[model samples]
Target: MRNTLNQRRSTRQHFRLLEQLLVATILLQLLNKPAVPVLSTLLQILLLAWL
Candidate 1:
């Protein structure tokens, strides 16, 4: 039981890390482009839904 709990915790940590990386990459890519308020807002909404 303890081992299973540890495995689950580790899995969650991995997922959290991946989520952070994905968000960071998206933000970085968007930052490279000229600012578009509407597009950024839509992207944020989509990203939130994905998470």
Candidate 2:
């Protein structure tokens, strides 16, 4: 019974860690947009010229 409780606690901790990681990834993507969005848009325009 004690082992089962420990397992549950560990699983909850893992889920919390995953949630934090997902939030961090989303925040990083948002932070990158201002720096990269225009570059990507320009690249798309160049690609269109090629096709």
Off by over 4 Å in 1: 33-51
**lDDT (Cα, 0-100) at 32 in candidate 2:** 75
3, model 1: CA deviation in Å? 0.2
RMSD of each: 5.8, 13.7
Give every collision pair in model 2: none
Tell me the tens digit of each residue's lDDT in model 1 across 1-51: 999999889778867866776676578667775545555576567557656
After superposing candidate 2 on the true structure, give the runs of residues whose Cα lies further than 4 Å from its correct spot.
33-51
Separate clash counts for every candidate? 0, 0
What's the true lDDT of residue 47 in model 2?
46
Estimate every model's Cα lDDT from 0 to 1.
0.69, 0.63
Which candidate should be chosen as best, given TM-score against the real structure?
2
Superposed Cα deviation of residue 39, candidate 1 (Å): 22
